[model samples]
Target: MEYQAAPARLSTLDANFEHDFAQRLHWSADTDAAIEQRVADILADVQKRGDAAVLEYTARFDGLQVDGMTALELTQAELKAAFDSLGDEQRDALTAAAQRVRTYHEAQKRASGESWSYRDADGTLLGQKVTPLDRVGIYVPGGKAAYPSSVLMNAIPAHVAGVQEIIMVVPTPRGEKNALVLAAAYVAGVTRGFTIGGAQAVAALAYGTATIPKVDKITGPGNAYVASAKKRVFGTVGIDMIAGPSEILVLADGSTPPDWVAMDLFSQAEHDELAQSILLCPDADYIAAVQREIDRLLPEMPRRAIIAKSLSDRGALILTRDMQEACAISNRIAPEHLEVSSSNPHQWEPLLRHAGAIFLGAYTSESLGDYCAGPNHVLPTSGTARFSSPLGVYDFQKRSSLIEVSEQGAQSLGRIASVLAHGEGLQGHARAAEMRLK
Candidate 1:
């Protein structure tokens, strides 16, 4: 019934210019050589020992003493019954969210090309074939908080992309999965789960064990250690992204209520102390109003201390001359989530070029996108969106080129192949192609 207080309207406004807000973007690599080496050592142990190493690290890192391997593994029956435990409302919500995510990802499914053959002077057929990854691992963070939504967001797409197996890892301090998480997993149709977490869980997923099978790709979000682990393990195994702390950039022209702006910013801030929320507006008055709103709202919210630190240290308001400058700044930052609360969202949407996800207008808050919205929340952060994209069905699939060379095709293709090989002075390669022609 009650909500965080909105900012009281100010009698006077400061229209001063402050473009200095550009300097705030900073993200440093948190793990050093020693930390990375330590993770590598633990990963080696997991790869060699399998379940024994996983349990050992679980005790050391998560502080949960484990005696055996099966203790951490969830049964299929347990996964099935998890859905019954949830109330009707929660179950219905999970079902709807799953459907929405499925629809969005299904639309993104790209069909595999069919086998084709044609005649060149010598006749050859060459094309690409699309195939899905056989298995993938989804890491869901827990301990401080639980996100059932994460289970839905990560698993359903992999399933839709036709991945054969989905193995999940969630850090459970109490050695138990969240009921909602289990319920979401059930709806998402994930079969196996492991309780062990931290860098060791990543290691197990990357390099299979007697108990835990290796995965082709790993996708999810976690702490700095998790990000660092993902970075190190790339090439050995595929990853979604090395996500930075969550961030949101709200570009408004003071049309929305200060309360709306404050809450949008707070949603990201509450994620972690390092999470950042910025407001870029042409109105300095709106900046002041939102600052007041943040102060009023902080005390009432559950994660008050966390939100306060995040806002003071990472939050900022950049007063721009007009929408043009604001658009430039938004593209420069390339925020994980961009909310265009300007005069016209449709007009501004085209002007923006980079973002993990775009939330147009005040009505489309980032929170909606986090939950029921079809777009993935596992987005590129810390400027990676400039080159990367949000995790989607494609992330769980692989593309292969299809080639069929007849004797005639090989004869014709071999001449060109041999020329390139000979030009590069690879005698063996040139001879191999020439043999097909002979």
Candidate 2:
């Protein structure tokens, strides 16, 4: 079958540009009703039946049937063996990437994950005590593809945060485990790993089965079922985010090679049909050149069918009035990945207000960040970047405000609290403050 790739074209000067642009940036993270219901039922079953339900669902969905829960768990020795089994090149790359990730998160921890306190004139000591979670479960998606990088991205930060135990779950459908995934777990300091995924894994992590210990939080990307399960169990446990499809927006000054820009768009498009890739530039000729490159290079990709459908359906080559306008549009999209593909990226970088991650310069590709650029690749999607931020050491650790009031401090604070408590008509609360007064 012949492959054809054509992306939608838009011009900022068009009369309907506002409406057209709004339509392009729209995407909902909401799951289908059927999927939500199925996830709820599975979660309830796992909550009630525990390991038995997990085994049953793993057998039905993953086609890996095992009598005991022990069979599903992978030991540290097995993970080490997987790491040792890799060729020199694979091991070198994995080690280098993991080190970079760890280094980055360690720096982040020192910067923001430390406890701090201050004392007032009245000897009122107040501050925040930062502490890591006792245990965390990281879900690594194994179906359709293997994400060794995800293991590094999710686990390394938690380890840096001083998390005591990191439990990983990755589905090995048909009992086929990806060596690199296990190797990543070994390198990233995952305390334990289980070959289980889907909503059942999430449920087990949230509710704690006979074998799988309940975690304080669950992090990582997953399919519809996993996302729905995470949403349902949010209060019971912390989740990273309900991530939407991958997206990348490139703001070009028409300085980089057209092929480079085209490939950057393809990087995100290859993820799935819903993935969005857009190019915004002032040069009409450059936009045309990039379109030509997209058509020329897409046929050579292994996932050409997906790339084709994604580009045809959601991708766009937008001609903006200028670089400033391009940045404005990029901010509005608040894309998961934004590439300032220009010589003077810094000149325009200050203008970008919202983006999951900003890839600067022509050489900085979004793929680099996805694999080994050090900053976390688990970013907020679906315009959530407008309010949230990338996952980091802060996500795995919590902060508690410390207040130690001196006798003199309590008298001042108590009077303020007593007046407010009385105004709210809570006699017990006002009396409690009065009791603390000097």
Candidate 3:
């Protein structure tokens, strides 16, 4: 089918600039009620029936009819075989990406993942003990699109954090397996692999099944069904976040080529019809040139239909008064990926705060960060970067406060605790502190 994409054109000087900008930037992450209900039913069933429910859902959703869960399990030998089956280029790329991710997370672990303790003047010990979750589940989207890079991004960090077991779940629709995904599991040190997915896989990971071990946390992105399931199972088991559609906001100073900016916009638009790609520039001529380049380059894309729909519906070429205004507008958006495609990117870097990842300079494409840039590709979306963070080694690990009050320290601390407890009308709490004081 033919497709035509026309991004919204807006100027900050317009009388209704704020209203138009708000309308253009709006995208609700809410899932449909029917899908939510269906996901709830699936989660409840999986909780009750365990492996049986997972098998049933796999049969119904993935077309992988199986009598038992064993048929759904993939052995490490199988994973290794899949790795061996890859072409030389694919194998080399996977290995290189995994190493870079691992190296970066190793640095992150040293910076923040290590335990720390300090002794106060009175000899009271206070500290934080950092510990990785015992087991973590990484959900890799499969069947139609196999993101082996996701396998590297999610698994390597958990591994770096010293998680004992890393379980991987991917759907094998129609019993078709993606070799690269299995190979990634093998390379990234997945403790186990299961060819079942959707909300059922999430349920099994959250509650545990006869075949699948319960995980301490679940991480990675998936479809709307998977996102809804993650939201539901959050308290029962820790989750990364309820990720929304991908987003990219480019603050171009017109130093970059117009065609380069257009193709960069296309990169994010190709992700899905809901993904958002916006350009903020001060130069009207540059904005026009970029639009022309978009029209010229779009037809050449393989996923042209998705690109067209996403750009036409959610994308924008916004004209700002100056670079300062563009940065201000970007901070408001809190986009998932922010690109400063300018001559002096560092000058604007300080003003740009609320982005999940920042690509500074005309040469740095957002795509590079998604794959081998050593930073996580799993980022906060739908303006969530304002409050949340990108997936990291820290997400796979947790902290516990360590407290040891010395006999000398107890006297001062006990009185403070007793006073607060008594003020709160808890006599038992007051007495407990008083008893330790002497």
Question: Judged by lDDT, which candidate is best?
Answer: 2
RMSD of each: 4.0, 0.9, 0.9
Candidate lDDT values, in order: 0.83, 0.95, 0.94
Tens digits of per-residue lDDT for model 3 on 201-273?
9999999988999999999999989999999999989999999889999999999999999999999999999
Please report, as a residue range, the 10-residue window in candidate 3 with the lowest summed lDDT: 1-10
Q: lDDT tens digits, residues 377-437, model 2?
A: 9998988999999999999999999999999999999999999999999999999999987
Q: How well does model 3 score by local distance difference test?
A: 0.94
Who is ahead in lDDT, 2 or 3? 2
* Collision pairs in model 3: none
* Total backbone collisions, model 3: 0
